[model samples]
Target: MNKLKRRSDMLSKRNVIIPLIALASLMCCFQLARDLVDVEKNLDYCVTQAGKTLAQINRDSVFPRDIEKDGKRWNFVRKEEWTSGFWPGILWYLYEYTGDAKWKIQADRFTGYLNPLTRRPAVDHDLGFQVFCSFGNGYRLSHDPGYKKAILRSADTLATLFNPKVGTILSWPFMIKKEKWPHNTIADNMMNLELLFWASKNGGSKSLYDIAVKHAETTMKNHFRADYSAYHVVLYDAASGKKIRGITYQGYSDESMWARGQAWTIYGYTVTYRETRDSRFLDFAQKLADVYIKRLPADLIPFWDFDDPEHGLKDASAAAITASALIELSTFVPDRTKAAQYFKLAGQMISELSSRHYQSRDSNSAFLLHTTGNKPANSGLDCSITYADYYYLESLIRLKRLAVNQTIYDYLR
Candidate 1:
């Protein structure tokens, strides 16, 4: 009789536990559904705002780079500018999101202004920024033969800057004369390697791929400190190809972790790993990402310099870049727990960025605000920069795709 009573008690407990588990799972599915709906709504808002901004800038015949401190006037630049590609890239992202013909039209128009770059000599490492972001996305979406030609030519131009001895591309040609840097390569240069990697596989010289891999490997060996935090610039001996020193041009100090520089490292290595299938770059990317994640403020947005939290200024651009990288990085991670963690953190960043706290909304035509561009030089401080908007839209697209079990690279196909 006692055994029967105990069995009945156990069965009763099991019945209650089963229903609770089912209820919890149902709630989780409901929350996920709600989150996806919110993502779509946010994307709708971004597309509308981007259209308005594009219309405003269309009258000027120049790419919009950032808003002034007053937030009334825009800072526009010519196609030769490093930031010129982001405006078109933003349009490309919008077109990808909505499959709208109007965005493709605008993207094509703006991207055309950069065709001259294909024929010109390498001005700096920014050929990738000035060309790839514009024509690369253009080619990806429309598969235009002209765009492919331009990309290949631009990749060849970019390769001109890579010194075989240094095993990395020279970042600032003008800086060599002005700053006395014999061979300076900055963390920002990592983002440009994609153009070479893509070009090599797509009918360009195989040397393009070799240059990119060497650059990644060289940067990995010299750009980082023991903690995996990257320096803004690493000076190499031009003749010997030896690292001279790691220094800072944009961070608060030579030792400080520059938010954008670290963000670039995370995004760049993620791309490198994707392109090369290199486990080393993948591991390095995760380490860099982990350090950045560990040092983030409570809001998930990093300060312009990780060491200067008391400055109280946030780099929304850095957060946006990291968020986009993290989402894509999550897809490549083999461990499910780590992948989920990365995805969740990326979602949190997107949520924070989409909130009124970061969105430019009524302040300006730009998507997000409070980016600290070249804070050390006092340029573009606390402003709405173009790349911030570009990556924010990108993160949203990545998140939306992943929510549907699709990879962010699905668009490449």
Candidate 2:
């Protein structure tokens, strides 16, 4: 009876072990094939696209905010918009990627557009988007003191918007005439805190860092739902600095999860943790990422607003931003499995975005990707935005660095 049982067990082991070994071998081969896939060709195409974009921008001598094509011609933004710095930042990254002197020259020229912005006091919370993305990348690449000075000055300008009583940065000034609530803080302001943190670490005032931390803490307390979704804006009483209520300026509702708002929070908290090494910020980022991952579609991209059941349109900008943030967040997450999962999810989003439906075919626009920006507002719907292309290229560079066993830099700082 014992011998019969032993034989039966041995047969079972043989059946399982053989298949397991074959499966492992196949997985290894599959991974090896994926690893061997040449990314340089993809980079070449992106570089060529970028070159075309540069030529068009130069030919027109315009700063692109977003693009609109009427089939006959393409219309682009020329004002010093919030996203103006992204073009220069793209040029700097292209220079970094290809070692091209012309890209460097163009980067400098494009970066000059935001220099005036840094000197003046910022009227809105987007100084970081304008100054840091351009001069920050410039300083990172060239270590130019001029760029550093501009960034520091911009940080100083940004600090003026901080409200001590509210414990947050004022995102927008009073827009309505004799409005009851004059102070508004938005989720997007979270992305700007890095400018303050960067200034503190780089010989600017320590108060800037304190203001950033306070703003993050306040936003974490007020802006997020129990499920980690964020509100578009939180209005406050200007004189007393008391919280009025959460509102939706760019989302479907105050209760809805605005895709870009969530992306900004994830990126902001991850960066706050990176700068401060605070485990609390890491925990905050992880919770938000978990919610985002759980809610994402099979394609790993998200709709414009997670709660907008009727108008569930894709926001490529949000996906690109989230993926870039996730890749960075993966580096800091201590749980190995979770980190791997984050990276894999980011890779999935990148793969989907790289497809023809998203990638620019003819490079007619001064941008690289087609994205849904402010869909509810009917602005730049299914068009190419400069910041979307910036983050897409940024994420690609990060993935390439990982593939080549190189360390990725926090270039935004």
lDDT per prediction?
0.84, 0.76
Each prediction's number of clashing residue pairs: 0, 0
TM-score of each: 0.90, 0.87
State the TM-score for model 1.
0.90
Q: How accurate is candidate 2 locally (lDDT)?
A: 0.76
Clashing pairs in 1: none
Sliding window of 10 residues with minimal summed lDDT for model 2: 1-10
Error of 1 at 28 (Å): 10
Off by over 4 Å in 1: 1-37, 58-61, 411-413
Q: Where in model 2 is the C-alpha error above 4 Å?
A: 1-38, 58-61, 69-74, 174-180, 366-370, 410-413
- Top candidate, metric TM-score: 1
Error of 1 at 322 (Å): 0.2
Best by lDDT: 1
